[model samples]
Target: MQKEEFIAIASKVSEGLATDQQKQLFLYHLGTFAKENPEWEKLDLGFRQQIEDEIKSDIRIQVFGEAKWKPKTTRLWPRIVAIAAAVAFIILGVYFFNYRNDKHLDIDNLVMQGVGPGKNGATLTLADGKKILLSDAVKGQLANEAGVSISKTEDGQVVYKVVGVRANEAGKNNTMTTARGEQWVLELPDGTRVWLNSASSLTYPAFFAKTGSRKVELTGEAYFAVAKDKLHQFIVKTKGQDVEVLGTHFNINAYPEEESVKTTLFEGRVKVSPFYTQGEALSEGEKATVLKPGEQSVLANNTIKVLPANTEQALAWKNGYFMFENENIKSIMREVSRWYDVDVIYQGNVEQKTIEGTVSKFKNVSTVLEMLESTKVVKFKINGKQIVVMPGKDNN
Candidate 1:
């Protein structure tokens, strides 16, 4: 385009009367002009002087009158000022719109709203079928079974130590089970660590066998940190599935109420499949959820989905907190009831409501429920140990 035409377009852009297409063209020209005129050090001053001179000479005369200030029927100065204001608004609108849209595209908010740590409550079952309330147990050695000394740590971990037994003869089978309102931590003979969730049990030899694979059976949910032993593969056998790993940390959710057994691998490799199936393996950063024998690692519909391992949420119970990220009221209550040893009953159709936050397990059940109710979605009434969850009315 001619310099006059370019200058006119630039003037229109400066006055905010240019269309989007025209503004784009003006920006292109301005870029090229800047690149070609590298020696123009006083760039801003030069442009301002040029615009000021043009506005005073041409635009001013067109708007007001000649230099002598002759009164004219049409006043152009007001229109120019209005146009300039409009242009500034348009520029600001475009910048803010783009910025807001980019922020809306981020996934951080969504992730922050869903999934959290498990709650407290884990019981222990003695060999003679007697149950011991673990959560209230005094911190020290509770008992010894066979060659293993079972001690409850100050942090509420049920640690099993091999005593008065040869390392080679360490594999005497002992089982530790947690009741509905409890969770437990066990340290295996090979230095492997297991965090047992509420309503779960882990069966392993008192001392790991020196020869074959170190295997343990689990029910419900547990987080495992397998000790490194290439020669002795560590295997976790649940009701329908088994996870085999050399050394790694992962979580296994094999709840009977849930249809699938989910194994989330956080670090290292693991092979997970149904107890009867063979050759099916899930690598690191992958979750193997077995619904049935032949079904692959997949979340079919909303009923059964195998999500990638969210370590913080999956092992939150082990870390002494309840973390909920966009978790539905029903699911959240299920966890709350399990850990606090309470029966949760819903008074209305409030399953659709969800909560997102983290709370310390050290807090009592009522305190945690109060925090959840603060979100204004649900309310709780504690009758004895039973918690009645009801939709909060406008007043409550």
Candidate 2:
């Protein structure tokens, strides 16, 4: 294909107006022409110049001050979007693959820009403690455990469909566990929807039958959209406390490594048991505190600390982005460690700085870490599976 033909195809691809046949032809031409002439890879110079002009003027700027990056309270998409938009036209309609071919980007290449995010896979433990790997299970009815029909979908979700005869009969309990760098969604027998994050596990009855109330034990973080069962209260039990609600949308962060367990309510009301009195978290015989929508209850120091919740931040993992706001390097690294399945080792005092940005969780580990390094607050050295974080020049 000629340069003019390639430009026309790129315009259509960028605008998302190409037909299925047109898209195929465009891709075929790209493979052939791009291989023969490297200069014609991205849009010709004429088209790129136009995009560059549009980007510089309208793109929102999020500034990083000094070697020690300053605190930021800025939006994410408006910043790098112009550049991403420009590249979308050139790179086969990839949405957020913000890549650059530069000598300074050697680390990026080592990390392999194609290293994408984790997907759904988990271990399902039956009442008999039989651990079944869901990834190995076929896409269909997995089993009929305790009269509940368990099935796996192509989209990577486990669904429990309650049978008619045993609708009120209690089935054996089951547990779903996702290790580091894994995630899985579950649709409980009670119709509740759960999005489980990495390094988390949940245990519940196979059937909600004949129970006084619905209860589940959680050992990690999860977002719940409870199905409204007015007669049956939904209670989530953690090491710290129990979150009881009728029907609500909420997120719970109860990782054992963290200092406290946080329950952020997005809709309806929830009662956090063993309510706090003050700064303490692990006190005995605490009372229950009711939290309204948009409030978060932090179980720490033997008390329930209530604060306003950022709903978007709580749901970022499920939405496929790493959203940070006034978060320190150590806290952010902990999350990266789980999602990327890498061990984090700190060097010097790297937690002195804060980061505020949004990047694609689906990107390679290098891209995600590079986003932080861009702020100049921290530097990372990849040593096999372990990442050592060091302080930036200003902090030194």
For each candidate, the alpha-carbon lDDT, in order, equals 0.59, 0.70
**Cα lDDT tens digits for candidate 2, 129-206:** 888799788888887876678999776689999875655556778999999888888899889988889999999999
- Give residue 135's error in model 2 in angstroms: 2.1
Per-residue lDDT over 287-382 for candidate 1, one digit per residue giving the tens place of the 0 to 100 score = 444322212232222123444554455655654456677777788887787776777887877765556666555445655665666565677766
User: What's the TM-score of every candidate structure?
Assistant: 0.56, 0.70
User: By how many angstroms RMSD does model 2 differ from the true structure?
Assistant: 12.0
Error of 1 at 184 (Å): 2.6
Q: Report the Cα lDDT for candidate 2.
A: 0.70
The candidate that wins on TM-score is: 2
Query: In the order shown, what is each candidate's alpha-carbon RMSD?
Result: 22.3, 12.0
